[model samples]
Target: MHNDLPIRKIIHVDMDAFYASVEQLDYPDLKGKPIAVGGSGARGVISAASYEARKFGVKSAMSGRLAEKLCPNLIFVKHRFERYKEISNKIRKIFLDYTDLVEPLSLDEAYLDVTKNKIGLPSATLIAQKIRDRIFSEVGLTASAGISINKFVAKIASDYNKPNGQKTVNPEDVLQFLEELDIRKFYGVGKVTAEKMYQKGIFSGKDLKSKSIEYLEDNFGKSGKQYYYIVRGIHNSEVRPNRIRKSLAAERTFSENLSSEIFMLDKLNQIAEEVSNRLNKSKVSGKTITLKIKYSDFTLQTRSKTLPFFINDKSIILENAKELLYQDSLKNSVRLLGISLSNLNTDKKLSEEPIDKEKKSVSVQLKFEF
Candidate 1:
């Protein structure tokens, strides 16, 4: 089954604790110490945590108070978006030096297709190492990489050797590598999905492979087919270069939860303005306005309305956001309010052509050199 498709040399590169690492890189005193990038206030959530903090079970998205409880000496730092974007652009430049097929997942991670690279390097492993080396030398940061035949496998392999390391899964080793993988480690399987899989006795890729596709689809819906293909090492998703922006959003977490809709009006206006600014900056507009509300108890709610025409103006955005806010009464005291615009003009159908679509047929190399 694998021999019919064109073999790709894909690499997934992820930075090591990006936000916290950036903070440490700028502040010398923070090196080799537990640090988190985010607010230390009551409503604050940790954006990222350094390796030193991870030893104490501190991690991103954990509450500031809980993180402090876990790591008593955890140092909190504010986020510098412009600084991070500057460093991210530098890293992206390094990626472009090797291949034009770079797909940035975020500020700290990207997928690169170096199957036919500018550098004329046949070995993807060597290319990954070179990229990692350049990142460290040029940007003063460390990254880990995973090299494999496709994006899905490469992404999972990248995490195998993290924090300044790299791993490769050759074509021949792909099936067995996936079979031995814990179901929990499969890229798309979250805790909830893993729990559902466990209920079905799918503890490992091998177990998942035992179930018929019909059985899988019956139990897991659309994702079941995806799992069936993935476990068999058959993901053909391309490394899309120009991934479109699906939405534009901005939100604020307040120091104290606001109890009344009138009190939230000012915050909502500010959030709408931010969203409008971002939409204009990106040169895109959307018809859908979504109001995101996070209550003090951590529950989240979203109200959305799709308009007939796209808009990027602050007044229009604020007006629509206000309508959505009043559409539903307060369920609880709001700790966070957000405004988002979606159904953007930039949205388009991504090409589904195979990586080697121009070629009629291709065979995987026995040894998988790249």
Candidate 2:
């Protein structure tokens, strides 16, 4: 199966602690100190942690309270996504200078197909080096690059030498590199899957590779074939250069549960404003609005409505959120409320079009007690 496919030179470039690094770059005082890019509130979660913070067992998606306990000196900084996006654009331009086959996974990571580059360079290693160098010189940030024969291996290789380093896996070495990798370290194999694999005595890539496709399918179902080929270094997923945003959302968990309708409305209004600001920043809108509620008992429920037209306005969002909130009485006291917009319209021109000042100025004000 591996010999049947062409050897495409793929490179995955990932920014080193992207958000936290950007914060440190902008604020010199944060340099050499442990910091996290996220909220510091009781229910807050860490979005990204600096390498210094990671030494203390801090990590992204960990609860902020736990991160604080892990690293007592950790400084929590609010996320500046717009600023990160600005730096990301600078890095992306550098990738385009080499090849148009760039697929961005997020603001700080992308997969580049340099099999046929603009500069006609033969070595993917050299191309990756130049890109990393340019990012440092031009954007004032460090990036790690992984060069391999395909996207799956390239993505994994990028993590091999992290924080201002690069690794290249030649076609012949692909299988060897994969076989030596830990099953837990493989992309897409989460804790649950890894535990299941461990129970089956599959601890590393070599163990996984030894299993028959029929056995993997019988155990893991549909994703079995995916693991079967990926372990053999046979991934053929092409770089999708035109990926679009699917949704925009904002959510907040209260330190104290709220049962009052007025209190819920006020929180909804704030969440709506955040969603509106992010939507306007990204120049996107959606027709579907989803309201998420999490009760104090940890039970969750979601309600959704699809509007006739796309909207990115706070007033519209808040009004719809209010309707969803009132649609049903409280089964239990809610500890969290969230609003999300989906079915996005990514057309730039539509977002850029002028809106009537009078209509856009309409704001929702909720009078409620804390």
Candidate 3:
């Protein structure tokens, strides 16, 4: 633990294969079966897969054709978003009972700051267990939790013991825990970044910590500074209760690729209508309209036009999208199309200050319990 950092108890709760688990819970026949929640068409992408399906390498974002080849008996189910939201709300209510400082990452995961909880329990580990138990008893779903001094470590720890288990990293063990962690397992290090780190011989946290801040910044830009600090257990980001929506979008993958501009007009209109409906429901409009095109070869392209004023009407969105669609020649047949709005009316100015920007006078507690 750093002497100038603040120590706070953070718990990250992530549900186990939420959508697939929900499906199994609602239908007894689906339980213990290899199930995937998504369309089972030629162009369909799996949204979620059950643990049984995962054993056969069936995973979210995989194509239905490939999943079928991997698991012969894979069952595809449609999404029930409203039901998922209802159950998520119930789980959120349980979190609120313990602490108001809860930051939801998604319907299936959240980060809770329980340094001073409503129940007056000093142990965050116990609170996490009780919350998980309550969720299983009340909502009929299992959740995993990770308890630590900050959000960064807690988020990673939650995955250690998954599918109805929890892990707590005490403050004193934070450094060693991070040092022994794989670089690929670090939250922000994706496949490309991990390969880059591997090229530089930075395979673990200890290896990442061996680099100079100057070297990291020069090589990895802004993210390098974050890596340098997080590896040292100095992440000070607070759990935000009200996370703002950054953008609104609607997209669809077609059963067959559209080769001509004339064939895309109808699909564009439908997508625009969906985006407009979502915007109206959120009661917000945006100045930036973007068109996303995914070709049959899987390459993606985006075109944007920022308007002088915000608009959320389907006709206006379709108009801008059409112009952007014709802005460039198509390299290949289009398989997917999308419309998105950003620079929204709901957006507000927020701070981007780094944790080490200013020094703290009080030393953080090194012996803080999870």
Candidate 4:
């Protein structure tokens, strides 16, 4: 439903090459050099890469061998998930000082709602600048931010100004911004989808808007509505107060430990069914499901699979979980079993995938509670 209501202000903040930058900050000797974070072994993939390495065509998720081919002297480092989480928490604290409406997308990116704030700051633009400055000074790292009327535009804006920069869009300028945007630049149009769209004459936002809503839906299923709203800067979602734990999971801690391969698979299937029921009732679909197990000797293991699209079917979840559980040899007795799902799409509206704009810091953060 489109409404000509007063616009809201929103901001998105993302750390630049967050993991790689932290590694550089902590290691010191690796500064200003091409570096990738991951193992260099045949099976290793780059989790993150510094901007210097990106210049040589290195990218995250590329095979370590490919990364090395791009940048011959590229340094590869193991992941440090714990350290990254610690820094993420610190950044959250900083955002809290200004507002309480923070939504963390991941360790390196977050959305803040500054409609109301603790600092009583007059403008969101100043708030965004301060956040960036403080993050650099306090966390010893750079961050990029985007400010706009809603999450869709704000997130895209942040990406426009990478490496310690910010971009903002006035509510009134949304049409102009979106009109000039390439169709591929719209949020949910992945590479393959974009190619299809291009073939159908959707090279720009104007082309998208020219199509009938019915036409879009016929071709793209449900997400075509998203294109309609974001192209006009009409996102109305409030910054949630807290994040809903998109999925809930439990892992049993065995007292003695049972080492039967069949037993481990059974436990995982059970948990996946539980998770699937919970998701359906919550009106959610999940794209990723993970399996976890622990051995009698206290050794831990996990495997995960991400589907091409979200689903809340119990049979699907359990079946995928079972497949992941048996992929490798489960010779040892297991002490724990767990299941989790992510990449949630709960009747998603126009989210952070729209018009590019300027920078504004949020004074408040929203957290969603289930």
Per lDDT, the best of the predicted structures is 3
lDDT of 1 by residue, 1-370 (tens): 3356657999999999998899899999999999989948888899999999999999987889999999989999998999999999999999999999999999999999999999999999999999999999998999999999889899999999888999999887888898899999999999989999999899999999888778999999999977887787777777888999999899999999899999988998888888988988899999999999999888889999999999999999999999999997999999899998999999887665544322322234545576
lDDT of 2 by residue, 232-257 (tens): 77676777688667899999989888
In candidate 2, how many clashes are counted? 0
Q: Candidates' TM-scores?
A: 0.89, 0.76, 0.91, 0.72
Instruction: Quote the RMSD, in angstroms, for model 2.
Output: 13.3
lDDT of 3 by residue, 1-370 (tens): 2465678899999999999999999998999999999949899999999999999999998889999999999999999999999999999999999999999999999999999999999999999999999999998999999999889999999999998999999887888898999999999999989999999999999999899888899989999988888888878788889978879999989989999999999999999999999999999999999999999988889999999999999999999999999999999999999999999998976533456633321234556556
lDDT (0-100) at residue 246 of candidate 2? 83
Considering lDDT, where higher is better, how would the candidates rank from best to worst? 3, 1, 2, 4
The better-scoring model by lDDT among 1 and 4 is 1
Worst 10 residues of 3 by lDDT: 357-366
Model 4: how far residue 101 lies from native, Å: 0.5
For residue 348, model 3's alpha carbon misses the true position, in angstroms, by 3.3
Position 341, candidate 1: lDDT: 92
- How far residue 2's Cα lies from its native spot in candidate 4, in Å, is 10
**Which segments of model 1 are wrong by more than 4 Å?**
212-215, 305-309, 326-330, 354-367
On TM-score, the leading prediction is 3
Candidate 1 versus the native: TM-score? 0.89
Q: In lDDT terms, how accurate is model 2?
A: 0.87
